[model samples]
Target: MAVTASGVFRRTAIERADQRVSWERTDQAFFSSGACHVLAWTCRDFYPDQGIALAALYLGDFEHPLHVYARWGRWVFDASGWNLESELLQANSDFEGLPVREVETIRTDLREFCEKHVHRQPHQYWADPTERARAYVARYNPPWL
Candidate 1:
């Protein structure tokens, strides 16, 4: 079923992921490098404190909460606070709507953040993304990220 952006469909991850992947990739799927995954989406905002991220995919899409990764083999709120798909952070999901220019800022900021964290190491592995990611996820989650 087709869904209007503002309706209940926005709250469902499956539907949302489908739309996001279609929109961004235009079916290109440049980032889907693994055979084990099924979907991906852009981020509108991320809550490291809550371990969750809000999605904003496709211009027609809206921001809403979605699961990032699991913790202790169970789904928990420990989000990674960043979406590689979007290459940005949704700093405030509560914002019902924001301009594209503002959203673009998120991408820029994210790149800067990654650079800061990745400097001073071979192959640019300065900060442990897995460990730092846990700062946004459950404590007991696998450290193998």
Candidate 2:
């Protein structure tokens, strides 16, 4: 089966959540095993050339989740995960509003961004504190760091 944009989104979400979990474990000295998962879609209006991306992130577990929606002009997060409604879907075309060719472009760009930059690489860090510190020093830090 071919991998879809939704699949890439889900996997990327999980990987991000897992990194958070690892950090939390290191800080709190407790371990919990679970990953974040996501459901995502895009919304577009060709006439206006406007678009939005929406996603729900099941953080660590499915019991509670975070909702995110973003467009060129706005970005929002709903911790309660209560805002999703049928009306929103209808208004946005369920992300099928853009031309068919644009769908592939969006998917490819998203996947590449997530894989290349957003997702953490294990080799970027080290188990030994000294080595980790040295690695950090050697690396070119981005603004986010």
Which tens-of-lDDT digit does each residue in 50-133 have in candidate 2? 354433333223232222222233232111121233332232233334222211113333344345334223332222122332
Q: Across residues 63-122, which tens digit of lDDT does each residue of candidate 1 receive? A: 422212222212222222222332222322223344233222112333443354331121
Candidate 2's error at 114, in angstroms? 2.4
* Top TM-score model: 2
Alpha-carbon deviation at 75 in model 1, angstroms: 5.9
Candidate 1 local lDDT, residue 23: 30
Worst 10 residues of 2 by lDDT: 27-36
For each candidate, the alpha-carbon lDDT, in order, equals 0.25, 0.26
